[model samples]
Target: MRRDPEPLLNIKANAEAPADARPPGERDPYLTHLGERIRSLRATRGMSRKDLARGAGVSERYLANLETGTGNASVLLLRQVAGALDVPLPVVLAEVDGHADPAGQEGQGGHRAAEFSQLVQWLAQLPAGDLARVREAARHALSPSESRDARRRRIALIGLRGAGKSTLGRALAAAEDIPFIELNAAIEQEAGASLSEIHSLYGQAAYRRYEMRALERVLREHDTMVLATPGSLVSEPATFNLLLSRCYTVWVRTSPEEHMARVVAQGDMRPMEGNREAMTDLRRILQARTPLYSRADVSIDTSGQDADSSLRALRAQLPHAD
Candidate 1:
């Protein structure tokens, strides 16, 4: 009797189905998306596995595993990769909003990942000036007009840790007779843990989620309040963009020396403890964040000014309530 070839063909077909070809529900969707994002980012940078591994200080095998969605990446490794890519760490770990499943149709999370990948490729070719214009245009297209009543009364103070956002924001809120909310404190309350505990136990991604939740809660509960945001809040584009769109943002800036002095005066030495390059790092951070910070509606330099004077200057710059 002649043997049938259909059985062999079926076996070959089954063997050829890759792990990714498995049912969408069978795979870890988040890890798959993360791998795709990392691979896309690496491709955009024109880096190979060897190059990226070397830059990220990981083995090529590990990089390959990550790119294939087979490796569990630690937060520290993600941070190292983000640094090597010259992007904010959150960028690596961020998911495309609304993307519950990457295998769905357009308008679902699946198309979003594709669209985001295309957008990144398109953006990589633009010059610096064009990129800035595009960013502004996107912000305008996505954000509502500045005349919203909710935005008018909600004042947000943004700056480094010791730039007097809290102290000045407290005084200003008291003078204005409105609620004053420290965003970090709100986040801690939301997470039912302190900031340090949140970061230690849940990592940066969890902290950011808590931060966003807290911000949303505050915005929902208070139509009028003064908010002092975490210094690194600006590093997360989505959260920072929301802050910019929802509140009247003011950058409370100061000299690096003054920032350091004030932090020390407040009995906080973490920025300087065991770090000889503290001032140098501070300057670098301020320099890198200047563009983002400068996007604020108003800026007040607190250097060489007393608290009362700074508060007065801030008030003068504010858009008074209707």
Candidate 2:
């Protein structure tokens, strides 16, 4: 009943070699070689398969298959695995290339070519607006002095309900000696209605329109302020991109457990009503929105950390703060 162990070979180098130059049976050395490199790197770092798998947000069995050269991982999966392993994907690819040819030049070219392909694939997935905003942000971050004449500093704080945006925004504002603005409060005051009433009477689309109006007003009125935004803003791409273009966004990240506890402490068990799957749903939502959250300029893990500690971490990451 024993299954055969997976074959280990250098598949990457063989693929790069000219058809006439490749040895017999050396079909695909790149993939196998890459897998071996990953395994070796993980081992060298004293990380177990399970540890690497967990860090990569994949199953241990998947990591096992990959390490044994049986799994053909996608570029995205490879990137995640590389991030978890604390090695750039190109470095891993280069290592594979090195194993293929002792001289190393041939493999280096292949690695660079593969990395360029991966970058193109990633850029293609982003929305046009998001991509443009990212480029602008990168340019500003790289050369602040050049951007200073037209660069208006804006900070948008985003997180799930009860993730402490309001509390931390106030602390951050105090620390920076800047104004703290609750965007929802501004919306409510402008509309002469509460958020729940607006959502209940007008629906989500209408509420978003109102939110956009409020955001526009804020942008025009305040040059620099810490703005707390709703978590569901991700669902509105246009509005989200507008905010991103105009501000340096920070995701006040919290664990599902911490979010649940905070909501419960506030006596709002509405999220848990009649549904045994509430906790599961919350976790799924958080996981799904992580990519959007990661687009923020900075992410601070506020779970189990006090407001002051969170504020300090935020301050440390910001470009210029008191």
Each candidate: what lDDT? 0.77, 0.69
**What is the clash tally of candidate 1?**
0
Q: How far is candidate 1 from the true structure (C-alpha RMSD, Å)?
A: 11.7
Q: Which runs in model 1 stand beyond 4 Å of their true positions?
A: 1-110, 144-146
The ten-residue window of minimal lDDT in model 2 covers 143-152
TM-score of 2: 0.54
lDDT of 1 by residue, 201-249 (tens): 7766788899989998998898899999988788777788889988999
Give the alpha carbon lDDT tens digit for every residue of 14-108 in model 2: 23333333355443455567677786555323234554575577998888777665565344345555667765566555433223346655576
lDDT of 1: 0.77
Instruction: Give per-model TM-scores.
Output: 0.66, 0.54
Best by TM-score: 1
